[model samples]
Target: MTRSLLDPSAVPAELRPYLAELVQRVGILCGPHLLSVFAVGSIALGDYRHGRSDIDVNVVVEPSLPGEVVRELAESLADGALRCPAAGLELVVYDSAFVGRPSDQAGYLLDLNTGPLLPERVSFDPAAAPAFWYVLDRSIAYQSERVLYGRPVRHVLAAPSQRHLLAALMASVREHTTGIGHLPDNQVLNGCRSVAFCRTGRWAAKREAAQIISESEPDFRPLLETAVRSFERPRTAALELPATEVRTFLAWVRERVEEAAESRL
Candidate 1:
C-alpha cells in the first residue's frame, strides 16, 4: 500500500506546527510507503474570511496506516479541539482504503486515517475568483495563507451562474443586509457592513479591488472599489424590487451583465 507521508507543502502556514506534529506522528505510527496529505478548504483557498468558527483540514493518508492508529490519532486531535475557543477543529483523514465507502459516512478528514481511508478528490475551476469574503467580521485568526504542507487550495474564479449564485447568496439579505441591493448604495454602508453584515460583502469587494488593481494597475484600487460599488448598487436595487415587476428584474439583470461586459472593455 502507498504510505507516502503527508506533504507539508499542502498544509496552510498557520497550522504548520500542529500539522507538522501530525506528520511526524503519522510517519512514526504508520511505517511509510504510500500516503499523502492535502489541504481542501477555505484556509488553503487564500480567501478565508474573518470570524471563521474553525479551520477545516483534510489529511490524506495511505491504506497502510493501521485502523487502530487512525482511531487513536482522531481521539487525540479531538481533544486538541478544546485548545482553541473561537474555532472548532476537525480532521477528515482519507487514503486509498477508505474511498469506496459512503461519502457521508466518513468522518472529518483526520478521522479517516483510522481505517481504510481514501484520497479525497479535488477539482478547481480556471476562471473562478477566490476573493476574500468575510466569514464573521474579519477575524480569520486560524486560517493563514502560508503553505505549510501541500499545494494551495482554491475556489472557482469564474462562475457559470454568477448572477443566480449572487442572487441566492443575497436572497436572505434583502432585509438583513442594508446596503447590498440598495442602488446608489450608501457609501458609508458600501465601505463596510457598519452594523449590518458586519464586515462581509464590502470586505470581499475590497479584497477584489486590491487584487485587480495590484495586477492590472496598482493605482486603480479606488477606481476598482468604485466599480464594485457600482455593481452592488444595481444588484441591490434589482434584488429588492416588487415581485410584480418580474420583467423589470430580468431587465436589470441584463443591464447588470451588460454593464459588467462594458467595464471589461
Candidate 2:
C-alpha cells in the first residue's frame, strides 16, 4: 500500500520540500481525529492543469462528529490553508468525514457538500478520474506521515464505487473541455480503462496508465486541468451502475490515477 506520506526528495527543486511539507502537515491535524487526508484534486490524481487545482485533500474523519469538534475545526480554519465554500471550509475540516466500507468491492463517493457541518456520519469519496470509476476497497490502507505542525497524519480507506467515481469524473471533464454535451475521448477512454480495471479485474489498466505518465516527468499542470474538468462536470446527483464490473475497471483506472498522482508530489 502507498503510504500517505510521500517522498519529498524527488519533488521538483522548487515544489518538492514545500508540497512535501504541506501534505505532511495535513496528516498531523488529521491524525488526531483518526482520519486519513490525502491530496486528491490535481495533485493526487496526477491530472493537474495550471491555475486549475489548489491544494485539495480527501479526508475521512473517524469516531464521529461531536459539537466540540466543530469548535476546534473553527480554529483550524483560521489558518489561511482552509478555503471557505458551500461546504463551510472546502479546503479541510474535521467536521466532514468520508464514509466507506473498505471491505466492499463496490462503493460511491459521499461528501458533505453543504458544509463541514457533518450533522451525520455519512460516507464520501472525493476523487476524480474522468474516463472511468474504480473501487480500491481491499487495496485501501492507512499510513502516517509528518505535516507542518509537529504532528503526523494517518490515512484510512474511504472506499467508493468504481462506476460512480467514473461518471462524475467524465461530467467534470466534459464541463472543462467546453464539451459539456460530451466527454473528451481521452477522459472517456482513460477513465473507461480505469473503470474497466476497477470494476472488473484487469491488470493491464494500471500498467498502461503508468506508461503514459512515466514517459513524462510528473507535473501538476495537467492534473490541475483534469481537476478543473471534474469540478465543471459535477454530477447533479449520484448515478447508479451495476457493481459487477468494478474489479476490472478499477484495475485500469488505478494505473492512470497513479500516473497523474505522481505529479502531485
Q: Which one is best on TM-score?
A: 2
TM per prediction: 0.37, 0.37
The CA lDDT at 248 in model 2 is: 36
Cα lDDT of model 1 by residue, 117-208, tens digit: 12222212212312122112111211232323333312101111333323332332332233333332222222222212121322233334
RMSD of each: 13.5, 12.3
Off by over 4 Å in 2: 1-6, 10-31, 46-52, 65-98, 102-155, 177-265
Model 1 lDDT, full chain set: 0.36
Clashes of each: 45, 72
What are the Cα lDDT values of the candidates?
0.36, 0.36
lDDT of 2 at 90: 28
Supply the TM-score for candidate 2. Answer: 0.37
